[model samples]
Target chain A: MRNDGETIELIERLARLVTNEGHAHGLKPAQWEALRYLARANRFSRTPGGLTAYLGLTKGTVSQTLMSLERAGLVEKTANPGDARSVQLGLTEKGRALLPLDGMATIQKAFEALPQPLRATLGDGVAALVTSALAARSGRAFGICHDCRHFAADARGPGQHYCRLLKQPLEDAEAEQICQEQEAA
Target chain B: MRNDGETIELIERLARLVTNEGHAHGLKPAQWEALRYLARANRFSRTPGGLTAYLGLTKGTVSQTLMSLERAGLVEKTANPGDARSVQLGLTEKGRALLPLDGMATIQKAFEALPQPLRATLGDGVAALVTSALAARSGRAFGICHDCRHFAADARGPGQHYCRLLKQPLEDAEAEQICQEQEAA
Candidate 1:
């Protein structure tokens, strides 16, 4: 059996191999992660605090990354209705256009190259480990809004969905996004 | 079954979660990865070129990281007897001592907290994925010297090991370390 230390090292190296990509785009790995999260995160979950938690990074680092994204015209700050002092982030059209060139594409291609059967098993195994890690740290489990306990479907029509926790209506595509406030059903 | 997109995101987030933990230390995630590699690598694998291929990053980034590590007194450069222009890296007293506080330990702990059976499976599965990724990229598969096809047992005595590729004797413990040139037997 492979030792736990060796196992951890394997995980670490895999992480590095994937994360180390995308530097060619002039964006750091952290920035790419932030951009990807911002793209998939719902409007309510697009704040810096939400990103900091989701990325498991310090507020300082997140703040700097956001600043750079803004300077590069890839991200824009919008006023938050809930808090006057806080702002929500959204990707500019330029950001959306550039995502296709993301370094993550390389990893996605690598992942796809795996035998199809192993893909699902590896996914489930990895998701379980993430849950365990969050549980150990008492950290939040960020997940898709559609999967959350608060998600109520058919609020208005067959395709319409609602968030019971936030008491907000979700657009068809938005409901499928990741949310900072997601709670397991 | 979980979709492939979600699976990729899961792997990405888990990587972020574990890698983000060690930022509490002054080192960047890349630096920590480099430090960890240096610690486990055999003397032959301690050069910057070996690290670049192992990391799949550009030589420029690796060079900058090494410079920072040297400035911090964590890594020291030593002359290469075979090639005067090239240098090999060795961890200094400070470098070796600081490893205990590596953010990687946080990941190691999280990996250990996983159910016993799952850990091995996860390790093997991850290893397979990495191998697949490397194959897809035509990248190097850096591994422990002991497992390399070139590894020879009892070349001089029962405890003595030899690296046929380099035609050199390996100390008992060094044979178990990672080698840049390692190949499957």
Candidate 2:
């Protein structure tokens, strides 16, 4: 059996590799993570609180990161319809443009080069590790809408989905995006 | 075939998981990474420049990180014997003790629960990904001493290893640790 220490080291190396890749696009590691999160998160999951939970960072840090992104014209805050007290986040055209240059292309190509079965296994293994780590800290999983416990298929209409927790219908695109309220079914 | 975007998302989640885990130990994500690096790096790989290369961060950020770590008493710096102008780093006893509580134990346990073959495959896959990412960024791999191109087994006394690049005999412990000068053979 591979020793636990060796296994941990490999996982740590993988994490560092991703962090190092973030430095290529004039963004800090945290900023890259936030940008990616905003791009993939559902509308309901795009608030400051949602980001703070998803990133597991202090409120101040998340706020500061958002301010930096906003100042760079990469992200904008819009009024939240569900709650006017808070705002929703969205990436600007410039931010969407920058996503292609965020250095994920190289990683994507590298991942695709792996044997197909191994790639699947690696993804499963990593997902399990993320779940385990988050569970250890009582952190939210921020899973995609389709996998959430509250997800209801075709509850509203054909090609539409529903969130039992949010009591709202979800567009097809939102069903595929991650949500802060996601819980494993 | 799994899409490239899905593969990249999995990799990003894995990285964020590690970053979130760092919050539990009262250390920022960068500080945890620095501590882990010092603990696993070989004697020659423990310099600030080595860390900068490994992390792909600015020299200023690395310097600040080292300063924070030194202030926390988790790391100590000593003059490098090979280079008088540079310094070497090592983990303090307290730092070594803190590692067990740095939230890796949960991950180690979770990893051990995986099937042994899967664990091996996962490690190999992650190592390959890390190698690819570092190569893309022109960053140092900081690989294990035994895997380095310059490593010569049993080149010194009986059962002794050597690093041709550093012209240094390697203790068994150092052979297993990562080195700054390491390049794939």
Candidate 3:
């Protein structure tokens, strides 16, 4: 078991790393989070309220982040059809381009720095653990359809179904719905 | 190297987990980071500028977070003698009391949720990768102090007074000062 101090330290450090990454792209931490959320959204129907809920931030905070995102040409705001006071947030093409594709490069560099034995010992499960922990810490759930490689409809299964990512089963309902982890091209 | 999409998905998941912990503690992620930072600080000082630089937050943002922490009774502010605009941030008794003494219990619970083999591997530094990655991303360096680890003050022979934490001979300056890593506590 790790100490609370240790866990807190790790979390704080992780936050700072993400903050730096955001800064590299000229965005604040909250703004980066808001952009990341938008980039991962599949259908582009995210309500400001939904973003606030997902981020565990206040409406004001979400509004502020969205404003910054808009200024950076990373997000688009549209009036909500169902409600007059609310608005829907969507990602721009620029936002899609900025969604951390180089993150893997960064991770690879970090991985290479580790001792060889440690890298060899880490399996898919360890990667899964990181996902799960990140999910748990971010107020979201991991192991969604997006994370599953088998989630492709073209794969062999009923209705062109099989999750290659998880190499497991993909539920019928999951195939039709968009996951928060899904990123639109 | 892992796919960038996959890594981002995993990180988002981890962020969610940390966010949940933040919510459980009745604080926002930023607020939690502030508390954890204060708890880990061995010595305290004043200046919104310093805290902003340390946390990588904007002045406005740091001021807001400090306001919230102060209102929650988790932190106290004092007049800085030299700088009138700047103030010293200190942990209140309530804040100190809020620090969990035995967070290993929580970590143990998280470990129990995982498989046994995985638990054993964490000790070998797989778990520490998250910290290392964060530090790298933030461009921060950290090393423990020699005095805290009991390095001999009077060692005539070169390389004799080694720090157990650093596992190396400490320079004269390093003996008295702690690095960013230890500051994470």
What is the lDDT, from 0 to 100, of the residue A130 in candidate 2?
A: 67
Off by over 4 Å in 2: A1-3, B1-3
lDDT of 2: 0.81
Candidate 2 per-residue lDDT, tens place, A2-39, comes to 35577677677777777777775688878888898899
lDDT of 3: 0.56
Give a tens-digit lDDT track for model 1, residues A69-101: 999999999999878989989999998888889
Instruction: Evaluate residue A18 in candidate 3 and report its C-alpha lDDT on the 0 to 100 scale.
Output: 48
Q: DockQ numbers for every candidate?
A: 0.63, 0.55, 0.24
User: What do the candidate models score in CA lDDT, each in turn?
Assistant: 0.85, 0.81, 0.56
How many clashes does each candidate structure show, in the order listed? Answer: 0, 0, 32
Q: Provide the lDDT at A31 for model 3.
A: 72
Model 1 error, position B115 (Å)? 1.5
Candidate 2 has an fnat equal to 0.55
Candidate 3 local lDDT, B97-119, one digit each (tens): 87663332343345456675664
Where does model 2 sit among the CAPRI classes?
medium
Q: In candidate 2 chain A, where is summed lDDT lowest over 10 consecutive residues? A: A1-10
In terms of lDDT, the best-performing candidate is 1
What's candidate 2's DockQ score? 0.55
lDDT of 3 by residue, A119-166 (tens): 654434345455345344443432345444435765665565665543
